[model samples]
Target: MSEVREYIAHARSVVIKIGSSALTDLADGLDKARLDRLADAIEARMRAGSDVIVVSSGAIGAGIAPLGLKKRPTDLATKQAAASVGQLALAHAWGTSFARYDRTVGQVLLTADDISNRAHHANAQRTLDRLRSLGAVAVVNENDTVATNEIRFGDNDRLAALVAHLAGADALVLLSDVDGLYDGDPRKVSETGERARFIPEVSGPEDLDGVIAGSGGALGTGGMASKLAAARLSADAGVPVLLASAEQAGQALADASVGTVFAARPERLSARKFWVRHAADARGQIVLDDGAVAAVSRRRRSLLAAGVVGVEGRFSDGDVVELVDTTGRIHARGVVAFDSDDISSMMGAHSEELPADLARPVIHADDLVPL
Candidate 1:
């Protein structure tokens, strides 16, 4: 409990995420009392001199009952329609509740593409920073109405992590229906079930080996898997995360370990590197020779053509590609300097042998990001 409290006490800026299950009822349009409870808790935090940003997930759920739908919509069109209608109501309810504390709320809707694009990412960071600086709590959500399959955030859990990274938040709190990550499903009630445990440290991916995956409530898309993924991502960026039940939200923020606490690391990656390493999809692989590997891994230099061994997949220049070693393990990712066709021709060639106009390294070391 002190561990959880110590974590929250140290966080100067926080990103608090409330899932649909926390803010809505099965048949109600929106749970106003629950929203007020959450708002009041956040207001207390703000009064304590901490900056808070709320990444809320309930637009579609809020619209479901109001639109006379029995359950969450199945198709994307209806989901988008629901989001369009529900977002206004969601913002209104939040605003009304926040007013009790004399706190202003600002809305920020983002799509996955917005963060993936460098320019848009900068714009988002600037906007959120300004809003927080002005003493307003930024209520963020995915722009579900305008997002397509290609542009969707998929889950708000991931969005919260991304927002924490974007906002340079001190910590991230993910409020869900469940208490926290369990060794196995607590519902199993087995003789050896570790129903509740605090994850104080995450050394690597193996730390998440025995975690369980489960679905969300009828109105949400993010489940335990997405929340864990968010934990890993945000933790990697040096932002600690608290995963707790919505029922215990106030306690969760009060230093109570109501859920699993993922400790943040000290060597956090830069925002660009974090987004590049985790968020971007690699379009191809560039296998490097030993010399290039040493240059990159040891000297932190851009990949030179003399170190190229092979190229895989169809990729255009400026697209993200994986840098692999002889063992076929990805060591880094970066924007490729040449198209796949050009790289194929340039492989195994000396710098002078390449055309003068194409003399640059295959993937400059400065642009490369180690995985």
Candidate 2:
């Protein structure tokens, strides 16, 4: 526990994610008071020399009241409409709250493509890095208005975990309505009327064996399950995670023992590799022979066309693809150098036997991440 606190205390860069339930009221719209309080906590961290990036989720919830909606929208079109209306209000609230501390908050909205596409991923990283270098706080959120159902992140908790890696954060803090994770739903009493057990620390998946995650709140998309998943993702990426209530933001940011802290994994993957393994959306699949799987996953070699037995989906060159074995087990993921049709034609042909134009490695080792 002390080690976790120390890790958080010394973190130079942090990503704090505030959930929709923490930042909005179902009856009202954006909660200015809550936003201001969160800004105060974030500003304090910045003032203490820790760079902070906020991944907030409240655009749709904030739009509910203004759009004359009695409840959270269920339909994609209605949700998008709410997000469109709420984003402005959400941004303005953040901007106004941070202005109190003479801090500048830059709004950065992104869709799933921004993280999955290599070029867009690089651009987003550069933009967030530049914002931090300029001493401005980046208030990030999913581009809800323009994001379709197919491309949505589904929940900001997952988005926040990915953002932590994208921003090169040292720590991640997830603030929501619940104070912390428990062995059971803390809101519910047991049959014997006993309170749920609070889990103060989670070192790995084994610790979550019997834990129960309740459904999401009326105004939010993510529940405790999503938070745990996000925490594990960030922790595995070498970023310590703290899950606490928004009301305890100050204490949590101060490294106080007020939340459930997820210890960071000892082994860390490079940002690019981690992105490839977890964030990049696989557009297609390339089925490889047993020899190919061994060469790629065991020997850590580049994928050769001769080893490919089949190609699936209509992916273009330079798109992310899964390298699977004959039995459908994914061995690796990489950016294919050829289009699906091109690969299909080149399958089972040795490099030397192929035309000069098609002789190169199918997926270079540098672009491949072993799963």
Candidate 3:
């Protein structure tokens, strides 16, 4: 059907995430040849007028053996240190591989903090967009060295989804060790068994429940479940996802039905709503007056100084917050213009009665990514 080709033929921008198992050797170091093949495939796609951003996972895995460790380190500090060393190695490998096609490569390392904060998210997107515009491939990875437990991407699968949303990517390809999602753990079942059937549609989380093929292998951080979750997120953003083996990278890009393709939702969320509902985590809440609620919920206008009634929790400017009406039901999620304390003071004050300096928006419509 045209629906399948529709995504592939029109995917001007895409996010391709390769797992550690695809990029490195569990026993030794980076797999340069496989890396080269992947880069070549990306180059091929670029030649076809697609802007590709690569989210890779291999830093800690590549650093494992060289640091005299037997396997992935358990201690956070050691893992961070190893990632610092391995990141250089990983970047260099990608750079060298990409250069073979006479193409330039740019390295981008991001943490969860980058997307959680509005400013950092904007800057990160701008940088990646600029790099792609300059005819360079932007190779991204998690900032494992500086990322702590609370701020780390946790796994690159989720990072790829966030990047897809940030880059406005049309599709997200998650390449892993397995071919695709199966009915059960394919590794435990015979190849000719019922589990070999590829799943074509996953309507909801229930469709994926107990459908894991395998957990994360020794070298990778993500398992089959994480990839499925990433697919769901991307699909919800109106961007379909492809879960396939790294070996089928080229075919997947060509839109071949060689793997599982998670269908996108028929309806797409508005950009701001998508950002607020999916990308940014809510930090606080702002209760609005009846008129203000009507303006935002129905008219979709910016929140002004007049409508605020109450504030809950501490939040900074540009942080996403829940917008609740008088009855205590959340009407939307938006960014707050003023901090919690400032909003508390601005509450119930009309624009004309407020001090000249305090008359600005309590929550700017543009700043608010309404959910």
Candidate 4:
């Protein structure tokens, strides 16, 4: 059940993310041959009755030569300008490539707000669902054209994982230039002439101990670190993720031994809870004492004000806030029961000693999502 082949065989829906270096060239822009091959792999999966969505990167790279830039733009406005020009080329390249297999592709651009906002997340989910039902493949990408530095998803790796959550994908395949996760630097041969050991399976987040992070490719923004982060996010939500090379996409989808696979978590989260865990932008933080941490993490109890030691940031009642430990590790997120100022005065008081209206748990378990 932990094997990638087994998972792919039963995966009815998938999100396939292609990294930039796999497709773009600074001198020539989008690589048509490579894109067509990717489309073929996607088409094969679609033909197998699996709904497929592509979270693509390469917009910035594609703009390099066409706009006569020697390298990637560094400034914000220039970067957005590049993305504005490149998005059209990226979308057309995908559309034309997929057309060879008679597949219809629809572009769906998104920003962080699209998922972080509850109402918007539902709208995005429904749009993807409709596209799948109509046999149209979704070509998803970050809307870099208008995204600001503060609001953008820095790389497509995390974006792909979020898209998997939004689409309820059973499997996520992240394609890069590297073969897969390795115990050491795959490029550096050992003293015994052995290459880095390729890790075929990671059962949980803790298993990622010895894996080294690689730098982004010349035309890409993500490295091994980002891909692993993406895998963890999707796996946490019960969707297995495959980390493989772009060359092995078809084989990977067919369940061949081609990449490292992250096992899906045993706990499947509800859609809203998943959103709260990953998408919600916390307006504030509530620092919990050891006793409160034990009560919430172990006892699964609501957060009473008696355990609150500190509060940071100004936020209103009902806003989402992070629940952190004394060491600042975020353990949960929940809708607060009272304003930050009100909660500050109520800290350390016994529940029964507080005013009747404030005698409740500061955050109810029903509204809390563990991180």
Error of 1 at 352 (Å): 3.7
Enumerate clash totals for all models, in the order shown.
3, 0, 1, 0
- The parts of candidate 3 lying over 4 Å away from their true place are 189-197, 203-215, 285-312, 316-318, 322-332, 336-371
Question: lDDT of each model, Cα atoms only?
Answer: 0.85, 0.91, 0.83, 0.87
lDDT (Cα, 0-100) at 58 in candidate 1: 96
Candidate 2 — number of clashing residue pairs? Answer: 0
- Model 4: colliding residue pairs: none
Model 1 pairs in collision: 5-255, 302-364, 302-365
By lDDT, rank the candidates, best first: 2, 4, 1, 3
> Candidate 1 on 3-35: residue-level lDDT in tens?
544776658999999999899865888999999
lDDT by residue for model 3 over 126-154, one digit each (tens)?
Answer: 99999999999899999999999877777
lDDT, residue 362, model 4: 94
Top model number, lDDT: 2
Off by over 4 Å in 1: 1-5, 190-206, 281-284, 287-301, 306-316, 324-331
Q: What C-alpha RMSD separates each model from the true structure?
A: 2.8, 2.4, 4.6, 1.7
For candidate 2, what is the TM-score?
Answer: 0.91
Candidate 2 residues 209-272, lDDT tens each? 8998876889998999899988988888888899999999999998647889999989777977
* TM-score for each candidate, following the candidate numbering: 0.89, 0.91, 0.80, 0.95
